[model samples]
Target chain A: MKTETKAVDIDRDKGDFAYPEVHVRDAGRGLSEKTIHYISDVKEDPDWVREFRLRGLKTFLEKPLPTHWASKDLEAIDFDKIRYYLSPGTGAKRSWEEVPDDIKRTFERLGIPEQERKFLAGVEAQFDSEAVYSNIKKAVGEQGVIFVGSTEGLKNHPEIFRKWFGKVIPIGDNKFSALNSAVFSGGSFIYVPPGVKVKHPLQAYFRINAESFGQFERTLIIADEGSEVTYMEGCTAPKFETVALHSAVVELVALKGAKLQYITVQNWSSNVFNLVTKRGLAHEDAEIKWIDCNIGSRLTMKYPGVVLKGRKSRGEVLSIALANNGQHQDTGAKMIHAADETTSNIISKSISIGTGRATYRGLVHVPKHLKHCKNNTECDALLINATSRTDTYPAITVRGTGNSVQHEASVSQVSAEQIFYMQQRGLTEAQAMSLSVNGFVNDLVRQFPMEYSVELKRLIELEMEGSVG
Target chain B: MNELRVENLHVAIGDQQIVRGLSLAVPRGEVHAVMGPNGSGKSTLAKVMAGHPDYHVTKGKITMDSEDLLALEPDDRARKGLFLAFQYPSEVPGVTIANFLRAALQSRLPEGEEMEATEYYAKLYEKMELLGMDRSFTSRAVNEGFSGGEKKRTEILQLAMLEPKYAVLDETDSGLDIDALKTVAHGVNSLRGSKIGILLITHYQRILNYIVPDHVHVMVQGRIVRSGGKELALELEERGYDWARAGADEPVLTR
Candidate 1:
């Protein structure tokens, strides 16, 4: 791992944007009341949203930085130096051909269009801070499934967006959440009507092209009664010398008898700080699941949470985190059982290579009055080198008398004997090590959708190269 | 000679000498059985020949087809036609038997060349049928949750798939029942031909009954004390290892 900071000045006009003649309009550097108002004016948000942003900004300014957890990396981020909002000087295009040439080139490289044609029912591509393109299949749109940008949803579908926005995860949920609420921009807003099931997944692609940028996307998904939907999002950024910050707030509401699954696969550059706050609310007999995969970043702290608010609801979180050299991945899940007969399960797997560090911080709570609320949490960590590190801190409060809870954790290293065994069978040492690491997380990887699961396996193989001496 | 030859082999694990000045040679088309008591260093000799990192070769020359076998890595040695069927095979979780064997075979190919999946699976099914293994075993993790008999069968399956020029079976029959013993012995016997050499290391003579050897050698204290024909095995089984241990006490250290 190269610890020295490179001298490369991030040229936003270089490899990502080949058309240097294309102008990118931006609500320039720094975060303050002025920047927030400028973003609101650019998007033409309603008065309530502008006020909401101002209040969020005030709350963010007052809240102190977290001192106890992942503080070192958090302190490295200079809030004043980040570019809060940026646009390619192009509005969201409904047709692929209508998108600008340079922006289209970037998504084409990311295979967004190819993926949308295959398994995704809808696609929304966000470059920097604004969504450049969004489109849903005609049949899916006819099914009363609304998929658009958060800004568009607020302006076009106010009745549907205003009722549930910030109801699950409020603006002041955390410092980063408040920060996201203040400078929030281009993220997906999805709503499935009653009894409507979206057969295919809706995907969002987020790319940070500029240097010293902060991408604060606010996503809200609402599944009405007896509805079901799956949404997946992926993000990446080019390697730059300076730091980039990504703080997003995602709120999900699964109404009575509804089922919703939210998946995220984040592979940011090594100079990015990815801190996110995500939470879901499940009503009676509803189900909410979070499937998350984190592969690369300088530092990341994200724990998708679920609040089972009504009777007999269920929640699940299946996550995989891998931290290569010069990276730290802090991720886990939170489940709150507020009603009787609710259940939740969390399975987290982490891998640390070279000098990387992975930390699993989880919270599972079943109150005293909530009878028959069950929970299970499992965490497994694999260390690839002597310097690799991992930590597990699980806080479980099980006060219910009739509920059953099970927790299991294990930390293990790849045994040299196993490597020799594989080598004796003719596999090289690197292949053997990667094989074992894949096996370590195979069960969890099997749960991911086929498109991302295959990619995740290939990514693991890439990271495992030269991992062993 | 087209064979595996060990001349004046002296190996040690840490400070304790194991294979002390041992010399043996098994030419192609022949099966040699090494029978000895516990702690006689028979298994150590097999490991040393396979280049186990823990067992240091203090002084020895191991040659396969007159090539320096000691100068290569274990995987390279395997690619160069060397195989070791462990007495206790390690479990590789999450790595299916099919993938493990495919990788092992893939290593032998030139770079940028891919093994044909259809041909590989067809050959795997044939070998599995020969060993009486269920076809479903290929998809299961390699040797994980396998019974003793199943582990032995998988070992032989790999041996059949790899088709190495020389193989060292270190106590392959240690934990097999009679039926399993017959199946494993049949699997090994099918591989016996003029192109390959086999060395069977065992503490008991029971396995020799199923797969008869061309010659028999009694080892004690890391050196061969007696060498004879197949009838010697029967004599040792009847009289026990006390004869070999008594002969071993005379200190036959000369190569």
Candidate 2:
């Protein structure tokens, strides 16, 4: 989580346009390179960042979206119609006090500050396309904890940012990553110095406000030897008739004996397409954990990956996603074992309501020379409506004779007797359905932070309400 | 107006009849016991009475205080005035008892009427105390990871809190130890008053030792063969149900 001031300076050309009335929120729309240039110019970004945006714009235009592995529904995305950027108040706020009240109220309603007070050591709140306020406890900062948004870190902390940027996840890894790296605006940058263990958690909140616009943020974290840090991100997008795009890239580095845990709860409205790339590199004796919960989206495609590069490294990914009508949640994990005695565990769970669908696509591979490496993968899905569908695709290739891999997958639905028991206890049909769905994904839900888990449950319940007759 | 009445009850599982030509009534403020051995349609009767969809009530009408219950859905029947404590409660994981009960109680409120938090907790605590439940029990999942005895006690706790006009304790004493039987009995006894009626269904009369019934009925196959006062349970316990099944060949007409 980043707590540095967001330098708020809007270019005179963009700032000269008066704050349009609320009625104009729905007036104008469309996607163009002008919109991209406008965003880069407004943020006063460096030349490299501007060039990155243009390159991403060119790639996005030339590349035909890969539809072979996704739903035909995703093909409905009209690239030319979506307004790619909308700056939140004139510019990003540099201090906590500089944030506007309306933006703060949204965070308050989402219980961001309360979460920071109760469970986290540091917190950052992002409104629209930029960070509005960021704060870290003095003690954490005193421990040489370098936490800031990716852009700020790139500008001020070159020694830390320059060495690792795009090294773990390169520009051409995927179309979305290229897009995110090119136009990325606001996400956390956390670097923990060697031999220092931070006992508390850090958090970042991402909220999307503009209709038909895209939010592309970049996040990077590097944990040095013998240190530990946990970072969490939560995002919410307003419900709109047209689809919004949220493409982000997150890169993590775990040095020898270091540990990093990244947690995310994405509850975007069903009108948003959430396609993101997140990966980590773990050196000798290090560990990285990914805990993610995906609740609402028109379609989501994310597979957080971990590459174990040195001896005795460990990694685990725990994910839970719930899909309802007009939604397709495609999510899983990737684990690569390159060093001896490395181990990884992956558990993914999903619930499909109405006619929604959930798919799990995962991979695990160990080279023949990587002796004594092990991996285990498990995927379980629960379907509520009879029309709901689930698919599991696991590709595990183990060449090493001493390596071991185990995989398990199951798909089931709620039984009539279970529903009857809940109803007989005085719950309505909808309440019974919600209880069962919540129970289905419980094991993974417990791994989330308390604040995030509560909000996740409420979102699941709200989505499960109208799916039953 | 204070009674659960069944008239010419006929229920079937698919095309085969399980409960045929049976009628029984228990007035409010009293505990009535119905004893039948296994495979005698005991559990099926309980399920059908609760409006479980698997069993079709081909020719029957159930009512609570002159209000038609057969027309209501299972949950609707519960909120309206009827409660069926299951023989095997479903294990609901990840749903704390507090939240589950809150949702149940919430359904009983008028539209747009929210429950007061303090009042809800105070009432819940009062019910838990009456049932000899620990405070931490409120946080545990509903019947998940619970012992047989704890599950039964939890059911009684629910009965106490919901305060239904009629409660069907289906084999509540089946899996309980003596101590659990006594505790569950105490909870049920505390709620037995003129405003409520109880129908205790079980395979054994040991539970009758703790919750002495005002009336006892002998059920065989699918029909109630006899009805008598509390002494009948002691007699049946001593002589066995085979005698009652044998007497079905003769008619003992006593008013």
Off by over 4 Å in 1: A1-23, A89-136, A206-214, A235-243, B249-255
| Share of native interface contacts present in candidate 1 | 0.77
Fnat, 2 decimals, each candidate: 0.77, 0.75
Model 2 interface CAPRI class: medium
Show pairs that collide, candidate 1: none
Candidate 2, residues A1-469, lDDT tens digits: the string is 2234434322211101111112212213554577667777777777776776787767766666778766677688776676555543322224444433433443454455443321111112223323322335355778998877666788878788879988888877877787676567777778899998988777664222211123677889999999999987764322222227788899999999999999987776566788899999999999999998887777999999999998999999999988887679999999989899999999999999888899999989798888999999999999999899999989898995888899999998887888898899788888898888887787788888876777666667666767787
lDDT string for model 1 (A1-469, tens) is: 1122223223442112111111155677787889989989987899999999998898899988886765476888888888777763232223344233443444444445454321111112333323322234455689988887788789999998999888887888888888888888877788899999999887665222211123688888999999999998874322221237889899999999999999888776677788999999999999999999997778889999999998999999999999988889999999999999999999999999999999999999998987999999999999999999999999999995998899999999888778888888888889889889888898888888887777677667767877886
Off by over 4 Å in 2: A1-64, A72-74, A78-134, A137-143, A195-200, A206-214, A236-243, A399-404, B105-140, B145-150, B175-195, B237-255
* Candidate 2 lDDT by residue in tens digits, B69-178: 88899999988878988889888877788878888888889987999999989999998998789989999988889999989988888888788888999999988888
Best by lDDT: 1
Model 1, B60-144: lDDT tens per residue?
A: 7999999998998888888888899998888888889998899899989998799999999999999999999999999999889
Whole-model lDDT per candidate: 0.82, 0.78
